[model samples]
Target: MHITFEKLLYREDYQIKLDHIVMNEENGNRLALYFRGHTDEVMVLIGDYSCNYFELSFEADCVLLRSSDLHELDDGVEFNTIPLVLYKDSALLTFATAWMGLKRDTSRDWTHYAIRAFEQDFHVLSPRPPVFTDLGHKMSDFTVRHSFNLPTES
Candidate 1:
């Protein structure tokens, strides 16, 4: 089956109001992105629940913005605030304003899923679809279980 990034991460108005990001690499690799309500009262989560690898990058414009006038459009308004987008056949997900990217693992032979933001890139090798959830007025009730254990000597 073929899936587009926009379709995979679709919302009613096609808007993603990012709240925070959660990453873990214990039993397995997992990257969870949380979104807060802006136009509606629903919190959404888009995550690579089980992934092999991931990466991140930060751009200067995202970090060294001394003034809003740098990229202001008019009346102190800015375009591409979050600047989240998909590239490389929807395998690369990017958040330009944040300057980050996520993409699929190229070295792996298995199927892959990826996301990127500006220059920050993250890649995940997994056949499963991303974990998506929506809860209305229950933002505090969401949970993702991740645990860590030391490797034992052979």
Candidate 2:
């Protein structure tokens, strides 16, 4: 099943708990996150991300998609709209930190991600939506296949 940004952004009742984070720069700077909430576990994969931009912080409360304000094409880009674009003046200013940059290319599809966690606040801008997959097994068991050790959240 394809999960769009719109679907992920509007869940007011669901407190998405981040289970695991995997960052592999050797594999095209791929970043994968396992989150459990609202029903089952799923993985958000950002593959071939070497060309993309990302930042990580030690602390975060929540995630917010950022947008820019200097461009006219962003007139329709809102906090919960499609064709995600992030600006510094958008509604997410209070939720979490944002990723700032020049006007995005309207010709290409982009996914603005602001993932907040105890050990890391991931801010990423990709040319496409991340691959979302439903986990068939427990997230703990799935993460064992790959060697990853993220600091446990206190």
| Per-model CA lDDT versus the true structure | 0.33, 0.39
Query: Candidate 2 regions off by >4 Å?
Result: 1-6, 25-27, 39-110, 116-121, 137-154
RMSD of 2: 13.3
Q: Total clashes, candidate 2?
A: 6
> Which pairs clash in model 2?
66-86, 66-87, 67-86, 67-87, 68-86, 68-87
What 10-residue stretch in candidate 1 is worst by lDDT? 57-66
Scored by TM-score, the top model is 2
TM-score of 1: 0.30
Q: Which stretches of candidate 1 lie over 4 Å from their true place?
A: 1-14, 25-27, 38-127, 138-154
lDDT of 1 at 89: 32
RMSD for each of the candidates: 15.2, 13.3
